[model samples]
Target: MARKKASPEDKIIDAALKLALAQGWRDLALADIAAEAKIGLPELAHIFHSKADILAAFERRIDAEVLAAAETEGIESESPRDRLFDVLMLRFDALGPRKPALKRIALDLAGDPMGALSLIRPALQSLGWMLEAAGIDSSGLRGAIRVRGLALVWAAAFRVWLNDGEDQARTMAELDKRLRQAEEWKDALSRLRTRKTDDAAA
Candidate 1:
């Protein structure tokens, strides 16, 4: 069977991820990534602006794959929480190949709040899409809160996931527990909102 060649952008992103994982994101350089990808400096520059951009591109690719998986898997029949679980599991599967890189990136950014800050926007975007993929609402003020909250939940699960061994049993357990807790909280908030609405009506 013939091997499918990666696109220019994929080649660049793959090279950058490998370099960042091998070293650290802070030490990654465009020239090195260009060399690793076997592309000229000018060509690499034409594709991405910086290491952060490359990381974001990689994340977007993962997000797209997760969304596609959600559709193909026909998760609409499941409950919202179950749908999200399935979608996220698909995301983890998509990221399976780069788990080591992700773990390294997390460790490198742990003490650097400012460095990790760049990911907040991208994380929010990813969560918003994840919510939508799970057939949940992801718009307006409520959507904003859901996105932020889910991002935190996912982040917590992701930390556990990084250390989880090949079975991923621990990661799945943590994610399920967290999602159940979130659902309980969501229910409580809904009840509170209903009471407030009744009070206002009275």
Candidate 2:
């Protein structure tokens, strides 16, 4: 089957990523992105308000790609951990082509704490979708914990991925290790909650 045509939003995202790879993200202006995308500034503004919005749109695009791939593969019988592992690796695969651009953005954003802080909410929201894709419940207090835990896991793995070779062995190892640690932490938290409930009853 033929691939679907890229939408205007996708075109702008592609242009921004391409520009980020060539010139770095921080110094590139919105006008640069518009010219790169072959669209006028008014059209670009209609789809995206700012560069941050473009980045967020790119993140959402990756999320959708991962989810679509997960749906096609059908890992329903796998354990939650295994499913989550697969889902996250799929996400990495989608991101692999743009690693250089992402690395530049990561380094530039590191100095901008508020910029980094602004992304946390969208990151958590994406992680929540990841949890659901893995057939895990991403709701309520336990879901909140899982989202936060996954955030740490993603951060640790992302740091490794930026420096990882094409084989991605180190990145995969880090992701696996972090997921195991998160599982242990989740179990410990569950036990603590149980203990507190028992004490309350007593």
Candidate 3:
């Protein structure tokens, strides 16, 4: 199959990530990204209002890639936990190449609490898609709990992944352990809810 051409937004995202790798995310201006992308500042502004917007766009792109690949891979026959594991691993695979740039960005963002706060919504949005791709429900109350649980899991594993070697062995181990812990917590919560329901009925 012929490769699809990169869109203007994609070009801008690619340029921004590349610049982040070279100069660190904290130092790059919109104009720098525009120059790197070979697009004028006016054009860049039309596509993205700020660096956070570009980061969100990059995350959305990762979500799309993982969702598409998961659809192709299919995991309907697997257990729910297994399905989620596969989906998340696929996400890590998509993120693998950008690890260095992401590390730099993450380090820079560590000191910027407000900037980190801005990412929460987009991160949750991506995680919701990941849950959906795993054939899991990501709506309403239970869905909200699941999203938060997955967020913690992702956060813990992401820290390990940032420093993990190219083999990703440690990242996979950390992710698996965290997922199991989350599963236990989820099961306990479900049982607690069941007990409350029974008590109310009685």
Candidate 4:
């Protein structure tokens, strides 16, 4: 029995993560990652142009994992909110082992507004996948609104998760609470819109 070899992209991302964890991303260089990954500079460069590219790839990897898990677990029977909860919880599970590095990245980005801003597109992309995994439509104006709202909710819950300690009980509680609030608001807005429609009809 032998361990399977990691792909070149995986190797580069792993090395970047390891280096980022050991020595913050700000101080990490492509040369260091190439060395850690045991690949030549050309090989590493072919896979990733910069640390940001590696990080983006890492985010996409996590999104793929969460989406795959959702398909395997089968969310067909669950309510929309429950499906979302399960999908997001699966995301945490995928990220569990990399918590330290993620936390460090979060902290570092907090001090760099531009860096944090750069993540907005990726964050929205991830939320779109999350919604789709939950059997929600992420299309059109309504879909855009849902994506933005969930992004905000997830961001707030993520902060709770970063400090959630080993058990993750707080993270679960916070996510549930936030989702509940969002659901309630959605219901209220629905009713309001219905009343407005009725008035317009009258």
Q: Sorted on lDDT, highest at the top, how do the candidates line up?
A: 3, 2, 4, 1
lDDT of 2 by residue, 25-93 (tens): 778899999999999999999999988889889889999999999999876656788888888988999
Residues 1-202, model 1: lDDT tens digits: 9999899999998888898888887767799999999999999888888777788899899999988888877786468999898888888889899999888888888977887888778788988999999889999999999998898779888989899988889889999999999999999999999999999999
Q: Candidate 3's residue-wise lDDT over 63-147, tens digit each?
A: 9999999988886647888888889989999999999999999999998889889999999999999999999999999899899
* Residue 72, model 2: Cα distance from true site in angstroms: 0.8
In the order shown, the candidates' Cα RMSDs to the true structure are 1.5, 1.5, 1.5, 1.7
| Alpha-carbon lDDT, every model | 0.88, 0.90, 0.92, 0.88
Task: Please give the distance, in angstroms, between residue 39's alpha carbon in candidate 1 and its true position after superposition.
Answer: 1.5
In Å, residue 119's CA in model 1 sits off its true spot by 1.4
* Candidate 1 wrong stretches, greater than 4 Å: none
**What TM-score would every model get versus the actual structure?**
0.93, 0.94, 0.95, 0.92
Compared with the true structure, the alpha-carbon lDDT of candidate 4 equals: 0.88
lDDT for position 180 in model 2:
92
Better of 2 and 3 by lDDT: 3
lDDT of 1 at 125: 90
**Candidate achieving the largest lDDT:** 3
Model 1 TM-score? 0.93
Error of model 2, residue 130, in angstroms: 0.8
Looking at candidate 4, the ten consecutive residues that score lowest on lDDT are: 70-79
Question: What's the C-alpha lDDT at position 96 in model 3?
Answer: 93
lDDT, candidate 1, at 61:
98
